[model samples]
Target: MHRKTIVDVGTDHGLLAIGLALTGKFQKVIGVDVSQQALENGALSLLSQIESRRKGIDPQKAALDVPVEFRHGDGLKALEEGEADIVCMAGMGVSTLLQILEQDHDALTSDLNRRQYTDLILQPTNSKPRNLMFLYKSLQDSGWELRNERIVKLSSRWYVTSHFTRPQSNIPVTALIEDGAMKIPGSTLDCTLSDSDPMRQDLEEYCRHHSQWIRKDSEYGRMDLLEEVWLERFGNDR
Candidate 1:
């Protein structure tokens, strides 16, 4: 979450990567997309942005300090383990998001796991609840930790965004909340949203709306698994 190198996966037009580079928040920004044309366009856009900032300047050679690259590949295949401090996936389908995260295991070299520094920032464009549930379950199962979640409404549609990091046993989930420290039986995890989390109201509404969809056979029932998961991850009795 702090200053670090960034890998923008599923990058469309590379706008976000470019923007971050312009802000100088990251030391490097690598934009990855499945489409070659998209990467080309993004590169051009990045160049144009730089040129616009300094007229009659060579954007590529300009002393912007931050290095930017565009790569063509599916999911995280374009990146090596520990190559990035933060991996961002935005405006992607739930299935694709899941697939990308699943593929991430391939990049977990020993050094990367040891540092536990790589972070994931995901924004799914569809299947919000299902995606949240999948992500929650996946994190718990894979020993990754959910650091934050928020809902954002744009153009009358809401998108759920989450941040995660490789598991750290030191930060118990119960430590995040003021009075919600009911211990999970099998794990020592605790999680809570900030009072100013953008979608706090919407999240509560979602948990209430999906209350009807709880199926007995479902792993987490009809409730938003995000809520069920906090308990499941750090609450369940072993």
Candidate 2:
């Protein structure tokens, strides 16, 4: 419930933006999409939500104080510099997400009004090693530091939601790649295997799946670094 301004990139039907606005947490929620029809649909959906609230159809009690706006554009094209303190991109492939982040980097470096620190929330639908590695390297390269991450299992599929921030420049891309490939220590692995924390358990499952998928695909480059990232977060010694 932070009073931050959020811009949802590739916001199809505006569900995320509208939902956030309904929470009365953000100062503004802007849904940006490439399609006009999606914007129209999202507007209608938001209107319906507002109508429901007016009629007391929905009972939660949090008044919708945030203003939700919809813009039509690709990636960050619809957003002006410094307009949003947070940017969210979800339900898209890693490649598309990378493109959007790259564009944001370019904009940030070029624009005078771009904020010094803008949070990036990403949910990449695909779990390829190459994709994951690319995301990792790209974030560091673009000056965004990985602050937190979570893995969720849904419908027998694994999805990762990562939170990043534009912190001070970090390790080199090659070093990051190496970090992700580093193997988890045996002791750390044992601890995570038996940890009762749900997030830790989900991470263990995510590692198992990610390791298997990457190995099956013969994407050997990221194996060690990926495991290293896991250990860095959940390892007993860290």
Best prediction by TM-score: 2
lDDT of 2: 0.65
Instruction: At residue 133, give the lDDT of candidate 1.
Output: 59
What C-alpha lDDT values do all the predictions have? 0.61, 0.65
Clashing pairs in 1: 173-189, 173-190, 174-190, 184-234, 184-235, 185-236, 214-222
lDDT of 1 by residue, 1-238 (tens): 6668888887778778777787877879888888988777776577566756665455455645546777899866777766778878888886777677666555333333643447878787873445555555555444566666666556756676777776554333334333443232112211365446655555554444443343332554455535454434423222
lDDT of 1 at 52: 69
RMSD of each: 6.9, 5.4
- TM-score against truth, every candidate: 0.68, 0.74
Give the C-alpha miss distance for residue 3 in model 1, angstroms: 3.8
lDDT of 2 by residue, 13-107 (tens): 77887888878788888888898897777765675667577658546543444378888888676776677888888999988887776565554
